[model samples]
Target chain A: MTTEHGAVKTGDVVARVEDLHVHFSVSRSAPVRAVDGVSLEVRRGETLGLVGESGSGKSTTGLALLRLVDATGGRVEVGGQDVTDWSRRRVRSLRRRVSMVFQDPAASLDPRLTVGASITEPLIVHDLAASRDARRSRVAELLEMVGLRADMADRRPHEMSGGQKQRVGIARALAGEPDLIVLDEPIASLDLSVQAQIMNLLRGLQEQLGLTYLFISHDLAAVEHMSDRVAVMYLGRIVETGTPEQIYRNPAHPYTAALLSAVPTADPEAERRRRRITLHGDVPSPVNPPSGCRFRTRCPAARDNCATTDPELYEVEPGHRAACLYAVEAVEEMRAGAATTP
Target chain B: MSEPVLSIENLSVSFSSRRGVARVVDGVDWEVHPGQTLAVVGESGSGKSMTVLAATGLSPRGAKVGGTVRLRGEDLGAMSEVERRRARGRHVGFVYQDPMTSLNPVMPVGRQVTEASEEHLGLRGDDARSRAVELLDMVGIPSPEQRVDNYPHQFSGGMRQRVVIAMALANDPELLIADEATTALDVTTQAQILELVESLQERLGTAVVWITHDLGVVAGIADQVAVMYGGRILEHGTVDHIFGSPGHPYTQALLAARPQPGVRADRLATIPGAPPVPHQLPPGCAFYPRCPVRGDERCRTEEPPLTEIAPGHRVRTFYRAPHSGIERPAS
Candidate 1:
């Protein structure tokens, strides 16, 4: 099925980001480079997962995509239109094409209004519907679309569960019929079972609506589950980008490998035999990041070249890219070790 | 295994408000022997933290707590209020998820940690200060002596949490209650804290009641696992039993819902309904509405008692494996 608005069909680029940079300036300190020279693309009908630590700039990249946060330098193209330095009116118009689902649905939702009113408010703001009855029916349809009961429209935000509130949030984002949806930590605050339900709902909604999602989260496994392509970010830079199989099994970058390796497996025997790469130090402040590579301080494969040269993301294999100078060598050793293990 | 370091029986906690009286924890019987870690896994409002709080006499105001909490054969519930307070730090150490709130921002990290040693062990002055430095060093805090003088805000988040762990270990208590200790930290920091706790547990042989929602961490660290649903223990057994061959339908669904690395599925397996709130819980099984394999009518009308499936494995339900075929035959 085609989306309500726009002609963005399957296999087309919904959002394109090139060398994007977002910096927060304080009076007495150096600018915090939250997102530094990162580039990615989200194709129509696909979920592109952006993953990193708290200060790794994944959220900032999502905000930049939605025009919620301003970019310092670079181009952001949403639905074949540039949104980097657009006027206020243009950005307001762009809002209809791209909507965002916030991390905490409870905090994002206005408790004073019922969920149905909350969902319908977007329709009125965007003038998507002609009349009140039409908007109410549209909200009901959206509630059912996210697997919520139609009777739940009258309940306040506090009356619903976390998963149900998130469904409302998804329904609100879908109200404008956005071609690209920036989902920021969608299922981070949910229970394991409810998280599964929400993830499944999200995937099913994407399939049904033909929506493209720039999914940003810190959860590696959940990101891998929802993403068609995964980008690993570290201290404001994209360290690696690849398909889930390439990123998870044969990670090229040391940061990516360490991030994946640190995840404690659920299988008891597998956890016992797993080789852990424990990164020693905390993430450095974004205000005064490292000179070249921000991850050099904690990277075990770091050498003299890391401090001097900021490596650009180079294609190590077909369609898989990494920014580490020792990407090939590090991944080769990991593969060799895995191959000889059994 | 050695004798049980901490034993709790028939523990239940309820809070009364204008809304109503809600029983948060219900009739839980658990024991942690020395050098054993019992992970209480549950989601929000599942009474995981309340179980530990009631045992330690830290329940909130207007809350009624009933149970017997024994520490090394001594009944803490029978003890006087002051005696219980003394038993808390000297015998039981508590670690919470948020370190910033646990530690005093204005006080030096040294004084906060040393305060435990001073009050519990009665070591004062230079002795307490030196012991604080040693505890900090034991928890892998670099430059222990210098950092000891620094306040909590001076340290990084991971460092502050390490200081909290240091303080938790200051008295070298036999039982440690860590409620989502690493939940607030980043993944890398979480790995470091887990390693620290594992090493400290090895050296100290502290019986730990580690409460968390992450199944992966439970598999990595705990010796035994207790799966809690609506403030009730749905299943309890060895980690191997819980992970390898789960018995309860709730436990089976939780394990399946979790997304693990290197495992892929077109869609995640999900329990269909939400967990019942404490106040609105049904008279029978709280998970019956969501249990895919619930086949028996008795599950909706009669509350299942905790029945032993193996020597140590127990499940609080009567849906035998073969009776239900929808999902893993009730398991």
Candidate 2:
């Protein structure tokens, strides 16, 4: 259940989820398995990118770490402390160690509050600042840290651009000085030009503060760029996990390969010659997912065994693992093919 | 050369509000011939969508449209409302970003697909249903005969999009306008939709005007690329020309900004500022504020005209071309 690969010596674990599950009960039917048996680790000062489509439970897993949603099963540990059984009042104190930045900055930030007030609220809530002047000074520092002008504190959310609003959201998140920050699709709404600015800012912040991030997004390219390690989620399960180089270069899982193949490159020449592995149909409903393998219904390499036996995270390399029965075979064949090619 | 399927000449669209008159699409000109896919790439408020909307006579209320839009060499502006509607029904098809909004939840998917055919092709009852089944099958829907009766809610997002695409193709329009059609779907689903559209275009020879902010999608599916900013096309050329040697700095910056899946960079290149607001646009180039390689005084004072640098490739810039070191000033 721990899913700690033997050779993954990536420093101390800042945050982790072991066999976590979150279910939402509907009226007359079974509960929706939003996050079913997902286990992951965020190493100290390193980013772990979670990539998936809508309803893949990537968000739910992140929420479980923050205790925003109650876990139905398994354990969630933050800073090496198991907090899965913690109550709401107890979880309030946990805010100092773990925080979240949501996707829509417009929706997250209050319209009535100034940028300074919004960031200051966190400082006051956590009792990080003693006086009003201290809170103001801290707010200014946070603003400058996120590449925004200190004068921006006086402005409201509507006065700022999408990228600027997101920066404020980041500033608010950093006010608590948390060890782990869950960035849920932080740059999805920004323009192409602005997205890069935010991504660079996040990377710089992570390095300067030695922070750990559980970056969740549907954008594969952004994930590969920002993350030290990548995890592919499918139907509320972590299907594969590896370093970006290992996963992007040579993926073991059929779902991972298909996802990678589907992302079109910016270079037209490369795109023209590329062979895409298109998956058929759509992601299965989470209410009643496929019996054995969640992805077998749409996977190209799925066989008879895939439909009967639930696959575990099979080791493909020292630090790379995939939840597919034939992943080991696929990885070996891929390496062989690579060796034979020029 | 064959005649263009759709053509717009110096088209400008403006909306007057309490604040001021904002020119959303300013003197834009583009032509899409049969079997050609022209991608209009830009960020929000870049007017890529407005250009097509105004050209197709589908601009929102209170919009003041100027210049000429021709469909199959016939002037759309000169036509009456009914005539324009008839022309649009017969010639143009659209697919928006969200399939759910495009489709009605209560109606059967078959009736929706058959609506266009019945209205335009004069098909009735059994004939219309049969045509809907064919369209669904063509769009790669399995068991199209049975799935045709399913409502929009019954199908998944990807399948619902397929149904919408089938609806768009019901009339076999000569021109297809897909505005961010794959933006809402996942990458895998997006790939499937892109492939379906490509294959359908090959068989039907329908011209496509794909409007999206994603340069990667543009690079993959486009024959021609037009990079729009501040309601004006900063760069326009064939995909090879645009991707290989982007003449404009904005185009260059956008390409650098995207994080390529396989390629790793220490830090992604960033554009300094936000996009220009339409009503408060600068006196000079719209991108002048954020232009990393702006030229002397002229680039900050005078707007650059669209100048032809090579055959079929035009760029609007005052400075020398990016990477080429060739000075092709606005003329």
Candidate 3:
């Protein structure tokens, strides 16, 4: 597929994953493939939504990007430098350029440390700020940037609300002045209104700081609003990649279609009119994924070919790509049929 | 019209915080008829949970509750602690968000379910055990007898939730309070849990109070809905009325804020500002700060009481006009 809107140029790639694979050894026989041969890029000043259900390697991918979990194979390049083989000291230096905001803010933030100290510690550890005075000033500035009051710095994580603590987490992630931020469900714990505020703050910060984001989330709607481009993952591989409009309006992958259909429409009349595609059965165990195409089990349009041959991601439209053999023809036919029906 | 199975009127709950008396739930009113699901929708700290929590006398210590919670024409608030305890597990059952936390980790699933029945219904040993296995099977847990002996840790997230539901229904309570029961489950499991709940409601004719923040989940399950903000009910109406013709700005913003799958907007109409803290609520409409349709002095100075808009729909907006053609009662 050719580069579309917000597609990262080779030079603009802030973080690049090349054939990354992460596997965990569980006994002597075989290993659980948490992330398998995933390749994607986070561009400067762009949000790439990495979306999937549980056990789809979304979290593992984020972890692999940060090198928190060692990838069994392939390379991770940050800012044109291959950090995949970096030492502890080198990795620590690299951490200053890449930071992560966890899904659960309450669990991520230290209970013993005050919010101020937590944010400032990152600055001090990374040597981003010169002195105590500088670190404090940076912490306060970051907090204010995230719309948190300066006085809240002294409070513990438990004392603050879920949204407030999440803001603190964002502030801490920003303390090192990282060019790339891996946001794993940053607003999942917050309320709808609060989520909006946080998302707006994130977008504003990205604009002001030129931050690159690898945004991972299960909430497709939030992802659509936040992401410039999206990668849909099933099991441990990227099944489709496209712009939000392309994915939402003309999803080629059947799993993508079912996921989009499952989201409830706010408009009652529209909801009644729309046909919801329900995928039967839960996600298969990642420990033992299905043969050939992993999505074949739940895919509505699955054929005998899908069970024997894994389809590579092929361009269905100008820039939209899907990893299913029949997706291109089927999607085109469906669109044409819809146009004629109306 | 038939009387509601559960009616909560003029409900107020105050917690004695170190700062001062914080009104967690203030002047909330709600009703649920037999076989109907009433979803109390709100964000965290919106008092939706506290309102229902107070009804069952389940509020933490040092919290003072003042309200009339009438269940089947009986005032639950008037009862003593012992009486309320007996009434709670017997007539009113509660399901929490994290099933793992609610169910005992060490105890077998069968023992847990039987414990509820034994305590509330006075069923003993073999009888309670038999009933427990039956309840498990009813909730769609396969091989109830064998699975019942398994610990909570052995069950999947969805199965754990099913175990919780089985325990909740052990006494066959008339009113079931599900406090974000399906929040922790995946979408597919959520669908199954909701289907189970709906089917159970049909079979038992039990009134359900589902408290959640996910508008999508509520749309699937709720027959009636109440949108709460800043410890107050901002809008209360039938599901069709609330979703189709939202009267309050908060409710409208909530509906608009949700990102549906296919709907693409330039930007989601997100209401700015977080929900106000309990101690720091604005004097006027609790939602005035974030309300898109802000009126003049009235919305900022004096609080608006929940006024009827139609036969069953009510809204707490001083602005009499409904934004989307829903009729409002004359002041």
Which one wins on TM-score?
A: 2
Per-model lDDT:
0.86, 0.90, 0.83
TM-scores, in order shown?
Answer: 0.95, 0.96, 0.88
List the pairs of residues colliding in candidate 1: none
TM-score of chain B of each: 0.95, 0.96, 0.95
Q: Model 1 chain B, TM?
A: 0.95
The candidate, 1 or 2, that scores higher on DockQ is: 2
Worst ten in a row by lDDT for model 2 chain B: B320-329
> Which residue runs does candidate 2 get wrong by more than 4 Å?
A7-11, A331-342, B324-331
Worst ten in a row by lDDT for model 1 chain A = A1-10
lDDT of 2 by residue, A37-70 (tens): 9888888888999999999999999999999999
Q: Model 1, DockQ value?
A: 0.64
Contacts from the true interface found in each model, as a fraction, amount to 0.77, 0.85, 0.43
Spell out the clash pairs found in candidate 2. Answer: none
In candidate 3, clashing pairs total: 0
Against the true two-chain complex, what DockQ does each candidate achieve? 0.64, 0.65, 0.39
Error of 1 at B126 (Å): 2.3
For B67-152, candidate 3 gives per-residue lDDT tens digits of 79987888887778788788787887788999988888999999998797788778998897889889999999988989978999
Error of 3 at B313 (Å): 1.8
For residues B40-87, write the lDDT of model 1, one tens digit per residue. Answer: 999888999999999888998888999898989899988999998998
